[model samples]
Target: MTQRLRQCPRCGTLTPAGECCGAVLQRAKPWRMTKQLVRNLHIFAMSRKGLDAETYRLQLERVGVTTSKDLRRDAYMALMRNLRALPDSPRWKPRGKGRAVA
Candidate 1:
């Protein structure tokens, strides 16, 4: 939603709607995914992709992250792409709603 600038009647100062007296108003920024959640997603993908412990460690090493818990958002994205591009690993499929795991 676009914030409408409202002019203060007495002071002639413009500010965002619902606020006055020269108070600065800023839009709220969307929060990034939490690191713990990222770790869970990475681990789940690895398990579904049939990656072994050694391979998991090797992949993290390639990304310069010693552990999944230490990975930043960008690194997680890069690692996810790398995981998807693995030639030999079985592709991980997302389970649909109401579908049972095989």
Candidate 2:
């Protein structure tokens, strides 16, 4: 049987599938990092969902997306996109207000 080698996206090292290379390369390049930062900042500012910068940072850290500045930005953008998809108005009926009468 022939075994194929998989290249690690992080370290660029080739190893058998499901094996750890023990080294992580930088995920995002410098230029990409700058661009992503700008994009994420813009999205956060425009979002009406009231994104907190500190919370977003924490979330990014939890998700293992903090390998580089660009990765952080990408995570922020993803959050903004998710928030934008929700309905703008509340769907719940008020407790006091019953059905409207004709």
Candidate 3:
């Protein structure tokens, strides 16, 4: 495996792999924890409901967002909780083995 060396633009110091050099030029991860978690929850919900665009957009509207990228951490967590409760949702109550639409 080839080791990648990162050059710090601010101080010109070469940072070793997997170490922080306290430099501002380092590339940060694009995703926050909530962002990735929300994405996963959204996928789970989609598969659980087979929701169309209109229905999905309505769900997002309840959280005051057009996209998950705009969700706050609290909202992201709350959305995950709600999605995880799909089996208990009144609108789509489970009957026998499959979900029954109300």
The list of candidate 2 runs beyond 4 A from truth reads 1-37, 72-102
Structural similarity to truth (TM-score) of each candidate: 0.49, 0.30, 0.44
When summed lDDT is taken over every stretch of 10 residues in candidate 3, the lowest stretch is 87-96
Mind giving the per-residue lDDT tens digits that candidate 3 earns over 1-102? 855566665566666544445544554334344655666665566655656568777777777788877777666677666656556333443444665433
lDDT of the structure predicted as candidate 2 = 0.50
Ranking by TM-score: 1, 3, 2
Clashes of 3: 0
Clash number for each model: 0, 0, 0
1-102: candidate 2 lDDT, tens digit per residue: 855566677667766656455644333343345765656554443343344566555545654564335455456566446545543323323353663422
Q: Which candidate leads in lDDT?
A: 1
Which pairs clash inside model 3? none
Total backbone collisions, model 1: 0
In model 1, pairs of residues that clash are none
Query: What TM-score does prediction 3 earn?
Result: 0.44
Error of 3 at 31 (Å): 8.5
